[model samples]
Target: MRPVGCHNEVMTTEIAIIGAGIAGLSAASELAEHRGTGEGILVVEAERDAAIHTSSRSAQQLIPSYGPEPVLELTRWSIARLLEAGNYLAAPLAWPSSFVVAGSPEDVAAMTVPGLRTLEGAELFELCPELRVNPQRFRTAAVDESAVRTDGTALVAWHRERALAAGVEIRTNSRVTGARRAGDLWELTLGAAPPKTVRAATVVNAAGAWADEVGALFGAAPQGLRPLRRTAALVTLAEPMPPEHPMVDDAAEDWYYRPDAAGAMISLGEAEPSEPCDAQPHEGAVAGLIAMIERETSLRITGVVKAWTGLRTERPSDVPVCGWDPVAPGMFWLAGQGGYGFQTSSALARAAAELVLRGEVGDWLSPATRDALAPDGSPDQSATPR
Candidate 1:
């Protein structure tokens, strides 16, 4: 209801979020929680619907101890919220699922994390009898009983609902084409038929793969965000897989498989760099995953029921980039979550909101984590590629 510009086709708000994906929706929900009464908030999305990209295509696993220390910390911070998401969701969002990691003796010996229990060759077979690696190749395994399967679609919907309930306006099919800074606000031009404009005091670039492009519209420098393609396929096995079978992953081989209904879902854990676009699964990648699974497991994957690909945008450090742009005032970066977006959504959203509202990292994030995920920090490109 507040109008800052004179044009009739122009709308104004205190904060404008430039994506409807899980990250944007989560940040909008948190910002709504801390916003003052009557303060306007708007979410602009180019897709016809929310969560139509990486959000819905995620593996949807909540593994708190999976990523780097900063990401693990964020995942740890999000566990409570994910567990309590039933209050906001129409149905329960997460279900307990076992996570098992396997590798050679040396590989397993180097793999250490808090609360992970080591398992011997027999123990691994006992846990997942269908696993078919040669006894000699199977050295050791670790189990994280705390892992859970998350409903990615339901979680995004829950966040959208919460943001809407807090009076945040969401405009779909509205793409932002350009942006410029006015006296004290950002003026955004949308790719609408009538060319509508939006004026806001602050803008949060949660555009996932297109985060850097969105920032460039407002003269912000790119943070070297790289969108990578990850391919997955669902295969129907000759025999029914146990519903309670734990999700098994070979860290050294970079492949994982888990039970899905009558079959299993598998991925090669490939992270090939790609341009920002609607991703498509490469037949070779799908076939490669199937081949690896057949070699590593006893299950005969007769046919593929379905296959898909999603983009997981990674930063230079392979950690999420969340915070205000160091060079651009009123512009915030909330992209580069890679594959950990769903697991770390709550904590990252809270941190983004705190940074936008107070211009500082919140207490939930430690000083070390703050430095690692800072938008201004220079990433070491010479390090080994992720």
Candidate 2:
């Protein structure tokens, strides 16, 4: 299949996917698995390389029970593939597990998610000895042991490369300009090598944080596209970093950290409001993270080796917005993975692909979900959250 705009006289396919991030790549891969070599998958990526945005910038971790039950369910569905010793990946992704520790009496309570139990103070520290308690920040603590530390960045690259190898056309630097319905198919315009247009019956908007902005081309409005800014700091220590250090969350999310190659990578986990632009680490955020680490543990506050920021897009309900838009037929949305994207990518992508490619969904969802999640109905269905 040709990209939206490739002057090269190539073939067209059944589907066109926008945004070659994890969601886009996963969708393309999933579609190909169902269709096989008979049809190719076309993926238009705005960036030059895969995972240049939040997909790659994230401090990779695989935490199945690190979020809400729905998020945990998504993570559990994807955990098999994530933990598989070998699969269709360019590089091995099977890595050791990681942990996510919750701080403060309130924050630990907040971490006591539904359908999952939070580890006690002793259990939390037992998993990771480096974690220290502070009288000031936390009156209590809890641990989510299912938080296995893995390289999600590697998994992202692996997914992209595998999708490319599967006869999937990955057009990098090809920012999608417009998407319009032409007859029964979609005529997509792109800003890439020698402007061109590709036609497909279906279009999947997996454009990461820019999902809503991209969906608008197909007559979609910015509804639940809430992109929150999250900052990260790459600081190296004088001694070898503890490889076994479980990822830790500070009280009130003021600061959080994970070990990376003998160095501790930290974040304030701040969901600051920001515009949809190239994000840079906020000085105040980094400073706050350092202060939290210093206050909680024996670690000293050294200068940040490097700092950067990325948007963690989420819906109003803070859940992934998968399936298709009700108003826009043949237009599917797999955005709003938020910080849980890496952990829940596989299952969410599969569930969405199934709904798009095959029109059948399990009746296991509640009555509210059946009404609220049906793509044929209005997204405004049901006054309560599904």
Candidate 3:
């Protein structure tokens, strides 16, 4: 990480990315990989450290069958890329790690996922006996064998390392408070007391929850990004969760639980709308989740050891916003990743890099999928998943 402290002099770069989370860092790494050595790429972070927001807080996973059609495509692509770069991972990222359960076969069929393997009777219980499968609920189970548990910390470090080695500068504690398009370049004002300016040929808005706000600074219209609050907790169960216990998700997408070294990590999986800020967990939400988990599963009584919250910013389509902003020239939208940030990051980053450098995403994605991710694309903003 390069340190460009509070200096009055205006720094210039070929590309400047706002936000140093998984999206920005991964995009930087990808962009740097294809860029000339002399072409400058800068990553600016508002927090003192990168990925301290949603990136570090996620119950890290790479669920290939977990999101919308577009996201699933990206997730599948990312899995291959991550596996190819597995040498950089601290732990093995493999699957049969995520399981989706339903009360009825109809529900399971409705939520059809590619490559989903439906399990039955002893075969299902043998894999995860912790699940309570009765006639009333959790009767059917399916496993996404392609879903992998990702090492979030290691992945972030790998991206940061790759970016730096490729001559990308990452500066922390440099919040972009103002933005203006200066002729052909975008001028971003950072910090106060001694505001420093950064000029770049293009600006990437990967600010996570603050994405829309950052775009407003650059005179771009609101992209309708919603920062939904999600809560998760670590609990002390009467019995320790098996190390191999797979992540169990309700077919309804209401709640999920996975084994953690401490015990088990659980979430009610609510996506309540929230204003962007340092999010805090609600005791009531945690309590509700505990009650639900106990009622639905055979896990014994437990106490919540820790609880936290993170925002999964999303567009109304529940898909990420990639490609150039229609109104703001030289400004690219790389936000609204929602809950599938890490899972689809590699593919999204590659798409972003290609869009930023070559002006097109090529044939990697279907024409409709590419249009769906574009800034001006018509996305169904009617309902954001709860």
RMSD for all candidates, in order, please: 5.2, 4.7, 5.0
User: Best to worst by lDDT, what's the order?
Assistant: 1, 3, 2
Q: Give the Å shift of residue 116 in candidate 3.
A: 2.0
Instruction: Compute each candidate's TM-score over C-alphas.
Output: 0.91, 0.86, 0.91
- Show the lowest summed lDDT stretch of 10 residues, model 1: 377-386
Give the better candidate number (2 or 3) by TM-score: 3
TM-score of 2: 0.86
C-alpha RMSD in Å of predicted model 1 compared with the true structure = 5.2
Per-residue alpha-carbon lDDT of candidate 3 for residues 112-179, written as tens digits (9 for 90 to 100): 57558888667776776766445457677777766788778888988998899888999999999998
Sort the candidates on TM-score, descending order.
Answer: 1, 3, 2
Rate residue 58 of model 2 by lDDT. 80
Candidate 2 lDDT over 1-386, as tens digits, reads 76675564333667788887778887777667766641557888888876778876687876775665577677766777776744655555656555554566667666655444465556655654445445444445655556665576667766676676778888788788877787888888776667668787778888887888987888864556778999888887655456766677665654677777637888877888777667888658777777767766766645678889999988775677776676666777788888888888877677666676665445434344333333333544322121
